[model samples]
Target: MRCSWLLLLPLLAACNSTPSAVNEGTVSRVADRQGRDTTTALPAPDTAATKAVSAVSDTLRVARERHNFSHAEGPSDLFRLVFRGPSILEGNAEFTITSPEGQVIFREMLTEPDLEAALVYEMKTPTATRAERETFVLRRIDRFFLPAQFHTPALDAKAGFPTDIANLERPTWDDLRKRPDAIGFEYLKGKEDRQRIAWSPLKKQVVRVQ
Candidate 1:
C-alpha cells in the first residue's frame, strides 16, 4: 500500500505544476501585447514650440546687427563726439582721432563684446573751430573683420566721409545724392548754418547743408 501511494503522489504533483505553468505563459503574452498597443497609441510630437524658439532667436540676431548714433545738447563751446555701433559677436574694435594739426589726441580700445559698444570723446577746442575740420577714425583691431558676417559694415558708407572727396571741395546736395554712401553734414555757412541737415532714406529726401 505505501509503494502505491508514493507513485500516486508523483502524478498528483505533475498535474498541479502543469496548469500553473500554462496560465503564467498566457498572462505573459497578454501583458506583452498590451504594452505594444500602448506604445503605438501615443500621439506624435508637436513642433510648434521648437519653431517659436527658432523665430525668437532669428529676431534677436537681426536686432544685434543694427546700430545708430546721435548728439544732443552739451557744453556751448566744446564739441562732443559720439560713436555707436553693433558690438561684434566676436573680436574687438579701436577708436582714434587725428587732430587737424596732425596730433593724436585720443585713443581707446574696446574688448568687451557683451556691451552695446560706444565711445564719447570731448575736446577743448571751440565747437566752431573744431567744426571747421575734424577727422574721426574707427579701426577694427580683430583678425576677422568681415562686414558681411556682422551685417553691419565697419564704416557706414552713407554716414561716413567719402575717400574720393578732396578736402578743398564742399560736398553739394547733388554730389551726396549721387553717392548713397555719403552722410549729409549740416553746418552753418555765415548765418544760415544753424539750420539742421536731414537725410531720410525712407522718405528718399536729402536736405543738404541745412
Candidate 2:
C-alpha cells in the first residue's frame, strides 16, 4: 500500500505540470503554469470573414426598399416586393415579390446597371455627381410600384405590334387587352428599349405586355 501511494505522486505531478487548452471565439489558447490563459493566440482572426452580411448590407454600404404593387388584388391586398442590396451605386440588387398568402410570385436579380439606367436620361452633362446618381436611383425605386408606373391599358386591340415580336407573344397581348382590369408596369432597358410586365392570373405567372 505504501509503494502504490508513492507511485501515484509522480502521475499527479505530471498531470499538474501539463498545460490545459481552451477555445474562445475564433481563437485557440492554453493555460500557463500559473493558471493564466496564454496571451498568444494560434493562427489569427481574418478581417474579411466577419459577421454574416445582411440583406441590404455588404459590410460596407447599406440599402433597403419595399413596396406594394398589387393590381389584381384590392387595396387590402398584401401583395408586395422587397429590394435588398449594398447600395444604389454598388452590388447586385434582389427584387422579390410575394402574394397575399406569402407565396413567391416573382423574383429577379438586378445588376447595378439596371437600377442606375434612369441616370442616363438625367446625365445630360458629364458633370453629374455621385449624389445625383444615387438620388435618381432612390426616386426610381419610389416610382417603381406607383399607380402611374402601372399601365391600365396595357395593349391597344386595334394597333399593330412590332414585326420583330415573337408570333407566340401576339396571342398574349390580344388576351390581355380584352381584360379591362389588367395592369402592367412599363420599364426601360438601358436607355431606350421599353417593356411592360404583369402577373397573369390566367397563366399563374408573369407575362409581358405589348
Candidate 3:
C-alpha cells in the first residue's frame, strides 16, 4: 500500500510540472490565433467607391493623352519668326531658336502676349558673348505650349480662305519715326509700349504694323 501511494505522488508531481494548454507565452488576447488584429479587419470593398475612383482616373488619363502641346510655324533666318495664334494657350509658351551650325542660339520661356516684345534678338553691345548675341542664321524656331483648348475654323473641302484680305507691306525706319508712338521723348520716357516697329539691326530684319 505504501508503494502504491508513492507511485500516486510521482504522478501528481508530473502533472504539476507539465506545461498548460492555455499558454501565457508571448501572445495577446486582442489578436487571433493567426496573429491578425481582431478589431482592425479590412472592410469589404464598396462597389460605388471603386467606380468613382475608376471614373476619375480614366478622365485624367484621357485628358493627358488628348493634349496637343506643339502647334506653330516660323520663317527662314533672313525673315523674322512670326507666330500668331489664339491668346488662350499663350501662357507658359517656350521659344527655341537653333542655329545652322547645330547650336542653340536662344531658348526663352515667354509669358507675354507678343513674342517680338518678349524677346530681344540682338545684343545691346558688340562685345557680348555668343549666348548674348549669336551670329548664326536662325535655322529653326520651335514653339511649345501647355495644355489648353483653342477655337479654330473646321477643315472642309468647301471651306476656302477669304481672298478679301489686303496685302501688307513692310514699313521703313523713317516711316516708323514719323508715327505718334515713336514721337518726341517716348523712348526717353520708357513708354515704348505702343511702338509699331520691331527691328533687329544686326540681322537686318524689320517688322512694322499699323
Across 15-103, the per-residue lDDT of candidate 2 in tens digits comes to 67734543344446667899997656567657886887666435322333333334565532332334455566775655556655667
Q: Give the candidate number with the greatest TM-score.
A: 2
Q: Lowest-scoring 10 consecutive residues by lDDT in candidate 1?
A: 58-67
lDDT, each prediction: 0.32, 0.60, 0.30
**TM match of model 3 to true structure:** 0.17
Clashing pairs in 3: none
lDDT of 1 by residue, 17-124 (tens): 744534544322223644652212334568767743332221111111111211112211111222344423433333333333344333444443312221122334
Sorted by TM-score, highest first, which candidate order results? 2, 1, 3
CA RMSD of all predictions? 17.7, 10.2, 19.5
Residues 109-195 of candidate 3 have per-residue lDDT tens digits of 433234233234444654545442222111112222211212121112243333332332323433433332221110000112332
Clashing pairs in 2: none
Candidate 2 has its poorest 10 consecutive residues by lDDT at 59-68
TM-score for candidate 2, residues paired by index: 0.57
User: Which residue pairs clash within candidate 1?
Assistant: 157-181, 158-181, 158-183, 188-193
Quote each prediction's TM-score.
0.19, 0.57, 0.17
